[model samples]
Target: MSFTTFLKSVPAFRSLATREVERLSSQCEPVAYPQGQQIIRKGDPGDAMYVIRRGEVKVPIVDEHGREKLVIRLGAGEFFGEMALLTGEPRNADVFAETEVECLVIRRKPLQDFLHKHTGVASFLTEILGRRLLEGDGIRTVGKYRLVGELGRGGMAHVFEGLHPQLNMAVAIKMLSHELVYDEEFASRFREEAKIMAGLKHENIVEVIDSEEAYATFFIIMEKVVGTVLSRMIDTRGVIPFDETRRILSQLASALDHAHTHGIIHRDIKPANVIIEESGRVKLMDFGIAKTQKEAEQEDEDIVGTAEYMSPEQALGRKMDGRADIYSLGILAYEMLTGRLPFDSPDPYEILRRHVRDEVPSPKLLNQRVPDDLAELVRRACAKKPEDRFQRCADIVKFLQQDAPAAIDLSKARAKVFTVIYDPEREEQVTGLFRRALAEARKIRGARISISDMNRIY
Candidate 1:
């Protein structure tokens, strides 16, 4: 049979126009795998979908304990990896050649482009995949966890409350958005997020229990915290009391310290990512754009963080470390104390520019009730230079543990001061000179400079 004829018989391509099918057939690359060879491995990034032309393959589902069970077998004309191709999710199962096999592989981009141009085929494929996710009773499940209710939705994924029938335990199931399934970057980040969270086991950090993929979509199972997000709490109560803020910041700091020690950096840290349980325990969640120390070093410079809470380095798209998280925590601390962000603007770029150029205003300036020492702590944490900020979250915790007035000497904390004398008459020239000097000084961690008007001083 002609390649186009065979493609027309495939369920996904059945609805496509003859020319569409011909276009897809022209893009298919045929390859063969010997019997006993592994065709696909679980957790590998999916790049293409395949249609069998000859022979057979066995699909094996592996359990948590590393045991594998043969789930299904496929023969000539059957297709596999369609879900991964459509969703950009990792392969969920291992496939082995049951016999010498020949497959016509359709690469991801062309197929996606084809689907984009043909909405009917895309919808048809979606309906077929959607049916595969539903059980006999009409309950939708990812692995063994059945989704019960939607907790929330974000740009990357939708969070659902789920229950495991066998385990009889409830969990928060985070499913990648279908709209983002074809976005390779988002898909990779979602998969890495699961791995990062699964490795971390801290009481103050939301625990990741498991991750699964069904019908080419990824789901992360996490412990459900019964509490409100810190953002909502701040919105409802305005300013949190100092004692409550201290407790929340301390717990959150410890969680961050733990993650940092493990070489993970939580790039997106904001009030919205924190949860305050009914018992007053703090649970830090969301590590979507996180990276390991090594990964950060190798990563291309891309600004990825919450604008208002971003560190100066992050705002400039520079490489960052755990200090970035400490800076964000400082912003969170400021919000908790003053009932407002240290920097706020309608335009995100303006906010990012402010993070890079302006000094964080003292929380005490906004709220008179803020203790001088505590306000100093927030200022240090949100310093324009990462080196000037608290080097570690553990240090933040230690500062919070001590009696603020006795533990911190305000004069010493502000001791590093540089005097820059510029002529007032040549204001434009002075401004340009100051910008150059400031840029150079920021390169040195913990370096401080104070500008003075030469006209006023002289």
Candidate 2:
């Protein structure tokens, strides 16, 4: 099929006048692919949404067993991946060529520009989006806890803000959504493990106030936290101060240590699971799939956990202990210190491969401000071999509290390493720029050069 034919089928372009279509067509490049090629993969930052002009493609989601489940197939004129234009979240599914295919790929930036330039076009798309949002089958939960509002939603469940009426307190409830409950194994496992969570009592762990099977839905009521999540805090303020980060980690390590003593392993530990409460306290939550020492994978071969935060063993589907949680914590620390994950890849399989086989770059590699001692701590925490990591949660707690060895060299880890040397050319350049800036400053009459400026010049 020709690009022209493809444009006619696209809803976004269908109503465009011939002249407008021609204008848009000139901006797009015609691209083709062979059969079985992957157009996109899960965890990839969606850059563009494509319009299928010819052939077909299959959209597959990663199932619990690390296998692919074909969710839908797209043919000529059909569009998918519209979400790419809005949220920068990773693509949720993988798109593969079912046969040799051709597509009109429209990048987000260009499409955004086109919409803005054409007010009528923009309004039409907005109306379409507003209608879709209104028609969305968002889960409607009965307010056992007075529903304040929604917190957030993921593939597993929709978190909500609610008030415990009798208790007269605010709390967040992670109610298992209908779709999530559809997976009998997941639902059963969640209910079974929830019983163990009831026994968990620790300051650092989010208190599981209540667990109930209400309205045919399994729900876990947890303490409501009002402060920023670790993930968001890191994004807004890159690489927290060493002292602050250490304090937070120390608290979490203590919590994990307590949980471990009770024979419970938090198999999934990530930034999202670790909440920084309003009063500057840290609390770990989400034990829905956590494995207890006495428990087994009870017939449910489905994989559960975030790919970005999974430990090497968890990624390989091996039986994991508390060490898995330690590894995840290490990854979180690495991310917090350096504004990026230890590894990156569009393919989940590829990402897992790197986790198992690749060497993670030291935190100092990306951010020079990272102390060598802190980087070493992160390295030990993320070591591929569980034995190589801080063997006990107590050890991590000690390290964070300044009680561990101080052998790490922070100077080498800093980004810009400069030797104390005299260089005439460099000195002159620096002095020239400084003197010029100083003269301009003096012209303002309200400013004066400091003694430090004379020392720098001399």
User: In candidate 2, what are the lDDT values of residues 1-458, reduced to their tens digit?
Assistant: 55655576677666556555665565566569799999898889987777777899998766789786546788988766666765445787788899999887767777666654543333223323322333433223334675667687665665767678788898877767533454566678778656766788888888777766653357777777777788888888777766557768888889899888898888778787787877879988788778776553332245567777778888887767788888888888888878789887788778888888887789998888776677988899889998899988988987765643244465653332223344666888777766676545543322223524333444
State the lDDT of candidate 1 residue by residue for 1-458, as single tens digits: 88999878877567567876776677789999999999898899988888999999999776788787546899997888876664677888888999999999878877677654543334334434544444353436778888776687665666878897778898998877654555667778889999999999999999999999765567899999999999999999888866678789999999999999999999889999999999999999998889998887664567887898998887887778999899999999999988899788899999998888899998888888787667988989998888899999999999988843234455776554556565567788868877788656644433345665545653
Show where candidate 1 strays beyond 4 Å: 1-137, 404-458
Give per-model TM-scores. 0.63, 0.56
Question: Cα lDDT for residue 11, model 1?
Answer: 71
Instruction: Mark the 10 consecutive residues where model 1 has the least summed lDDT.
Output: 118-127
Pairs with backbone N, CA or C atoms under 3 Å apart (clashes), candidate 2: 64-302, 64-303, 368-415
- RMSD values for the candidates in order, in angstroms, are 18.5, 18.5
- The model with the greatest TM-score is 1
Candidate 2: residue 365 lDDT (0-100): 87
Name every residue pair that clashes in candidate 1.
87-181
lDDT of 2 at 116: 45
lDDT over C-alpha atoms for residue 321 of model 2: 77
